[model samples]
Target: MIAARSLFRAGAAGVMALCVALAVPAVAGAQPYPSKAIQIVTSVGPGSNFDQLGRVFAERLRQKLGVPVVLENATGGQGLVATRRVLNAKSDGYTLLLTSSGLATMPAIVKNAGYKAEDFVAVAPLGQVPFILYASSSVPATDIASFMSYLKSNAANLNMGLLTTSHITTMLARKFGKVVGGELVEIGYRSSPETLSALLANDIQMVATTHAIAGQHVALGKIKAIGVVADERTQAVPDLPTFKEMGYPTLVINVWEALFAKADVPKDVLDKIRAVSREIVSDPSYLTAMVPTGMEPWRIPFDSLQSVIDEEAKAFKKDADELKISFD
Candidate 1:
């Protein structure tokens, strides 16, 4: 009887041990997410607008989450490198990607972008940066019409530089080419910094670049703004004429960025991120800090982000189809 009792005790102990082991993970998972460091990967080189924004936002996020938030600059392949990294990461709330809308929409233009818009979900809508078509001061044209005329005549001599050949910069450049009845030599740089350097050195005669890069150059008279590809004149350069005002309404375009994570991330974690982002963007201090950089907040709730992306994608597809823009 004692031997049987001892065996019963042993079996009970084993069952209890298994139950504890099984319950440990459930208990652990119930603990608040982000019990560890978080990483925000940017799809641009250091010193670019996205990189700067990522650093600033990471600092704020760290404060909000009580965890160390770090930035990783994953440059190259027009953001394909960073996108792939984020996609492959675990769906846990630790890893995130801050990249431009181009990452979602570029596949509409490039056949082999390697990812789709549905693979990721937007956690926050950061801001939009108006793009400007800039020409070296040596160019005779001072406005979009005159510039297009010049491009038509100097098509063989002038080339346009862009941060990436697969982005809106290239889209606008190709549109200009089609409108002028001539093709401009399109050169792709890895980032805005490289494109700006090339443009200033006259390595490329024309460029589609952001206000953060071309604004100071325009002020210094080192480069001329052919047109701002936005719906309205920006506060940074209120005197500049938008493409719409310049008679080419179809050329108006702006590049925007957003925070993203894998689609399967926990809803509660996603909500927490969205709440923090809304707070960050709504803060006056954050707005002021971003003003000099010419970025404007584009706030949208988390639930609405995917629809916005889908709408944007539809427009991009329409334009790409019309332009016959295919990397293949």
Candidate 2:
């Protein structure tokens, strides 16, 4: 009886030791984790490029983190409404904000944009897309030089259309107008659909929008791409030279998307997230899913200890000096 009791005690001890041994990795994994669902907040709508990139990141992160991801959209204020939601959420890894160049331009457009570029850190660079200079074939300008000339000659007569009043389009249009010494009749539409419909109906003479929005139209010969707004040409439209190559340099800006979480996540957690981000963004499966939808995956990683909040710190610094945006 004594021997049996001793054996039973030994077996129990061994089992407890095994459990403890197994628990170390389990606990470690849990430590680096989000044990709950993750939230990805974006301002772009369901079919927009930014929204698509945000969803792709969420899906990939969900797979790597072993948790479901929920994408919440706030859809306006040039992406601030959605981004602010993430910034205000608890700084835990569970919530991430997806953003584009508007992070650099929002402070100029709205008062109390609530957060700045320093507010969040970059997890990955989703991809880059070139803005196309598209115009209805119904208009007479067939090329970049001619387009500028026509705009200059018919400044009061020509109308330009894009996504929003406070968007990069406005700034670009202003720059273009300044370069050519002319004023554009700017039509600020909320979405590409309305913008395209108006252009198709000859309601607008020109549009500076995405190839995704304009590609189908361009292919159908409904519109012509006179120039690209990127520094380099795109694979889809290699023959189209950038505005810089045609003499306008600063106009060459590629739209980009980046992943960001709160500024105060743990170092290890950030490293893990970065690792997963690199894997996810570079994974061919992710690219396959994104490319068909017009999103190109590019990974630009950041360490957790790094300064996402530092980027937010100077919210006012990136504001354009000429911008006179008023909340009231």
Candidate 3:
């Protein structure tokens, strides 16, 4: 009888051990989201306004999310590579895309952007960086009026440097040429810094670039800002008037940086991210850091992001169609 009882007790212990082993996987799988590091991808290279803004926000997000936030610069295919990378990544909110207003122009210009603006869910806005039309010091112009006249006179020989064909700056540059009644030859460069360098070297007569990229050159009188492409003049270049104010109201284009995740990312995870983003953008330190970069805090509410993207994409498509611009 004692031997039989010992065998039954040992069998019961074995059953309990098996049950615990079976439960371990379930417990591990149920752990909260973001158990690992998150990556933010952008098409721009390092030291860009996008990179600077993204890095600052990433640090704050890391602090808030209690996980490492890594920034990866994919930089190719006119942002198609980075866009597709985030689009194809797992929809667990671990991978994200940090992009600019130029994203809206992708579908309008690129025949196969692989994803539409709506395919990604908007997480948060970083800031708005206004585009400024800049001319090399070699150009015989100081302001928009004089610049237009000079462009008309030198239209046959002038070249306008474009950062990328799909960028808003390119669209604005094309439009500016049309408005000035001149076909400024388009020269493409790999990055804003490169574009600005070409402008400074007089390789290109004009370029529409961000103040962050061209402000120092303007300060040293190496290049002159013709006009801003925002709705209003920016404090960073208070003396410079906007294109709108300069009688070209249709030339306004403001580049905004924002975060996006795969559209199917779990709503709960997105909610957590948006909440933290709201906190970070509102922080005083964050605002102060962006000032010198000519970025202004411009937050789009979580719910309004899709409509804004849709509207912007539609507008860009219309413009591209009118301009007969297409990469394909």
- Cα-based RMSD of the predictions, in order? 3.6, 6.9, 4.5
Model 3 TM? 0.86
State the TM-score for model 1. 0.85
Q: What does the lDDT read for residue 90 in candidate 3?
A: 91
Candidate 3 lowest-lDDT run of ten: 163-172
The residue-by-residue lDDT of candidate 2 on 91-208, one tens digit each, is 7778877777676557555678787656666676777677888887777887888887887788778788867734667666666776778777888898888888888888998887
Model 1 lDDT, residue 317, Cα:
84
Off by over 4 Å in 2: 1-30, 297-319, 322-328
The most accurate candidate by TM-score is: 3
Q: Output the number of the lDDT-best candidate.
A: 3
List of clashing residue pairs for candidate 1: none
TM-score of 2: 0.81
TM-score, per-candidate, Cα-based: 0.85, 0.81, 0.86
lDDT of 2 at 81: 80
lDDT rank order: 3, 1, 2
lDDT tens readout by residue for model 3, 1-328: 9999999999999999999999999987886867899999997788877788889999999999899999999988888889999888899999999988767668778887788877887789888877788988888888888887777788878888886634676687668777877677989887777888898889998888878778888889899988988887776778889879878888888678899889899999998899899899988999998876567777677679768877888888898888777786
Candidate 3 regions exceeding 4 Å error are 1-28, 152-154, 292-294
